[model samples]
Target: MKLTKIALLLSAATLLPNLASAGTLEQVVKKGALNCGVSTGIPGFSATDSKGAWEGLDVDFCRSVAAAVFADADAVKFIPLTAKERFTALQSGEIDVLARSSTWTSSRDTSLGLNFTGVNYYDGQGFLVNKKLGVSSAKELNGATFCIQAGTTTELNLTDYFKANGMEYKAVTYDTSGQTIDGFKKGRCDAVTSDASQLYGLKLKMDDPNSVMVLPEIISKEPLGPVVRQGDDDWFNIVRWTLYASLEAEELGVTQANVDMQLKSENPSIKRLLGTTGTAGKDLGLKADWAYNIIKKVGNYSESFDKHVGKDSPLGIDRGLNKLWTQGGLMYSMPIR
Candidate 1:
């Protein structure tokens, strides 16, 4: 009898961690908000506005998850993190989801105890230099000193690119993107290197934006997206599908303004996506209207992109690789069915 009792206790103890990890959704629901990790401030990605509310593409992704769970896009507490701090915060459970402009790399996926949901943005590492440098191409910047964000793939890509090109350069690393830009502005380095999207965002922060220009060379592929802890498949699915729901909504011609009208869509894919039919929400431990809420509250991926980083916004970035698959770009969603 004592042996059986000891075995039972051991089994229960073994299950405890899984049980705790599985309750992330429940914990967020009880807490009344989802804890979302974002960058300190990346314009058109994640940043506080004049009203002190977080707004940007990555910010909208967090709102989509909140809308899925609570039907409230505003039920999110955004925690701003520097480059080196983002992953540690997620690993420590300081944030439920991380939506900073983080690249999805094999090392990060296998070693960080985290899982990237999917690529929300396709990016590449590039250089930003003062127009006065008279260098229109990255090749001209050989032996230049660069201000780079520490603890990012940007740093590694910079090293590899320079080495492979038989060029030598120096890197002055900063703890955050803001500091890197500041370092560049202060003339601490000849150029700043980061994901091209970020270089654009950083350029906008300059006293005179036109004084700097992003080099035409894209040296590395950066598939940036949201991330969640690895042990909880339930929460993982919730985050992953929330992203897919937005992409699917866009593919099906659903928008925040038109999601309500889409309820009557007879098309099977549209119906499944809008929660007019199917068990997608139930499979993910959510209400049938969960996706409907996300669409109605957060808008589709296109809407968020356009509003935050595309032509409608200050960034005015073109939807090159970020365009929907049907439109000849890489953004594609799995079938909701």
Candidate 2:
């Protein structure tokens, strides 16, 4: 009887991989479009223009994945979601992946039944205050009122920071950033706090960005990235490595202008990446030239960063921690082979 029970467990384990892969990719193909979850409106991250067309870093991420699958970046339907609604949308299969800016945390990973692919942005919590407030540092803001969002890590982190610093603060909570910023503008709070990247984006909408300055201190690490439901490993791999493809393309000297040229190169890694030399794509249940589609359509990590988040954009953040590892940053991809 013990042997029978052990045999049943072993057989179930062996069938798991086959069961998971049996129709996931096929289902996506038959659907004709990838449904992507993204932030409602955050400039440079994800936002809808006047025409209601979605665009930004997160939008590009979804497009990149669509490019890999259908060879057409436009083959995607964007489902805009707020922070609280993102996970539910993904779990309900309303979206294939949540490309919204979400911090990767142990609790979110384990308890939430979500899989974070990898970090796209290395951000941190920070404070943005009017320069006239005469505050040079966050530590100086004792007993200050702050404009913050409710039901977010920003709120919890705000509480913990004040508690740890022995500071007193009044939190003027709001559900949306528009309301939070309006409250700050109306003098309801001395300071406004959120992710540092968000501070930059938010400040761009202010009457004068020079009037509001971000504090030098960045508290708490925020490794933000895309996420998906936990059960589908193949779907997870496709999304995760679609992000990695951008980074890898930049590292390998492939760009939108030169991906076609590089695809003909004789280098082993580059060839495997371009689908000329290996089964890398087939292993992921995608076309051999999956990376090529992303590179040709969406460009690479550097291109995406420069176009949306780098110095040329209003946010104008230096890619200090986001640069490729060889350039002394943390953007690294696992081996494609």
Candidate 3:
């Protein structure tokens, strides 16, 4: 019996760390608000208006998670972070989830003690230059001074792309996207390099947005997504499914305005996603209507995209690779059931 007790004790001890790791949901519930990390400012991604209200694609995502948990999208407290500060804020528990436009790379996923929920945006590195530079292609950028944000995948990609082409350019690094754009505007650099999606967003911030143009060269693949700290499967599921729910909603023709009617959907996939016929949310330690709340309050992925960064928005970006997998794009969700 002594041996039996020892074996049981060892088993219990082995489970303790996992139990502790899964406590993020409980802590968030007790706190009554979800702390979401986002970019300091990036138009159409994460940015503050003149009235200090935050609204953007990333901000909407943070709100979506809050809606899934609290059924109140406004229950999120947005914590603005820079590229250098984003991971540390998540690691130190200063934020419950990092919804910033963070890239999912091997090192960031494994070496940083973080887990990327999934890619929300598929981007590629590109360059932005003033129209007067007569640079229609990135190849024309040889010997140009490029303004770039420090501590980003864009930095390394820029270096790699230039060297691969046997081209030479000087880099003027800034700590923030705003500063990078400012440096470019002030003629501190001849061009600015970043993700193509970001280059579109940043252009809107320029005094003469029409005067700037993103070149036709894309250098690197950047799968941008939300991130959570490692060691918490429950929290990871919550964040992951929140995004997938949005994607699935769009694919199933569910929208913020039609979610209530979708609750009565007869299609199996729609029923399962809206929680009328499955325990998808309950399995994640949330109410059965968690995904329903996200769709209704924060909208589906396409809705968020169209509103924030697509044709209807100032950014006017196409859905290209961000479209559903069925529509010749890469966005796909796991089966809800």
All candidates in order of lDDT, best leading: 1, 3, 2
Candidate 1, residues 113-135: lDDT per residue as tens digits?
78999999999999899999999
Sequence-dependent TM-score of model 1: 0.94
Write one digit per residue (lDDT tens) for candidate 3, span 233-330. Answer: 99999999999999999989999999998788789999989888778977999998899999989899999999998988989999999989999999
Clash total of candidate 1: 0
Top-lDDT candidate index: 1
Highest TM-score against the true fold, candidate: 1
Error of 3 at 240 (Å): 0.4
**What lDDT, from 0 to 1, does candidate 3 have?**
0.92
Q: Which 10-residue window in model 3 sums to the lowest lDDT?
A: 14-23
Writing each residue's lDDT as its tens digit, candidate 2 over 119-140 gives 9989899999999999899999
lDDT of 2: 0.88
User: Cα deviation in Å at residue 40, candidate 2?
Assistant: 1.3
Against the reference, the lDDT scores of all candidates come to 0.92, 0.88, 0.92
- Candidate 2 lDDT at 316 equals 85
